[model samples]
Target: MSQSTAKAAAADASASAALRARSEVARLISYIVIGSGAAFLSLRASTLPTSRWEPLGAGSFPELVFGVLAVLCLTAAVRAVIDIRKAGGANRLGTSFAKWLVARRYSFALFGLLVVYLALLPLGGFSLTTFVFLLIAQLMIAGISKKTLIQSLIAAMIFSVGLNMLFAEVFNVFLPRGVLFAG
Candidate 1:
């Protein structure tokens, strides 16, 4: 094989090893939870009132969406299970998990930031939350420097506040308002 191809093959082989069992297990668990949640939502959506003029109920779209989501999640769980099996078992899970975390420290940090940003959105409003998230995420990616910080701030403000205004004025779609900010 060519040099790059051989390197890729080696990487793939390493990726397919038992080191990934922990991540696969995590994926499996998340898929199961998401699938169950979607199934529950679908069940709830089925009870929405139907109008006589329309063939479908008001909840029909939601039901279809949630049902599809549940099915997809289940499929993903199956794939995760297959991956877990291929990666061996729980024997090396503990040892390999630390290695995986160390190797993906930056990814995990960004993921954690995303989760926090999402969780805080309702409380902070779309404008403030989006701006903060954009600034921090950009800084994390670009590294901290005075020029980059200012640039990130400006970009974040433009996108966040500008988008909020565009949606409110042009599109007539009002974003979620935070309790902290009284419009």
Candidate 2:
């Protein structure tokens, strides 16, 4: 083949590979989210008590919600599988997952921060926990710098304290005060 033809062919191959990688990643994410969410919802719905006293019963809402969610998830999973097949199957799923992980390391780190924030919420209280979570998350996402640090601190304070005050005073809703700070 000529040099120009060879270059064009290589470019086409590269584009095709990228497309396939993206398709595989989409399929994997869809499968994980929809499948897991459906299962979780189903379990949660099952745990809700069925009572004859109430017209619809306590489990009615949860059961309905879970049923709908399961149907939607099934549809999405089927679609994802079809897309994966069209993109040449999951032969490169591992490679695609690795590349996606590397590319989204920061996102994964932020998710970890969120998990920590949730775990500490009851212990540290809403205001304090939210402030710390926001500060750390903002710094990690926006990078550390004098100006960004100041901005993050201000934003965290405004969001945590300001929102807490609003909820407590205006909305008449009290957030957790934690064992240490509870009065």
lDDT of 2 at 109: 92
lDDT of every predicted structure (CA atoms): 0.87, 0.83
lDDT of 1 by residue, 110-175 (tens): 999999988988899999999999999999999999999999999999999999999999999999
Residue 90 of model 2 has an lDDT of 66
Best by lDDT: 1
Candidate 1 — which residues are off by over 4 angstroms? 1-90
What are the models' TM-scores? 0.54, 0.64
Among these predictions, the greatest TM-score belongs to 2
- Sliding window of 10 residues with minimal summed lDDT for model 2: 19-28
Pairs in clash, predicted candidate 1: none
Q: In candidate 2, what are the lDDT values of residues 38-144, reduced to their tens digit?
A: 76887787787788787777777877787778777777777776777666756777777777678789999999999998989888999999999999999998999
Model 2's alpha-carbon lDDT is 0.83
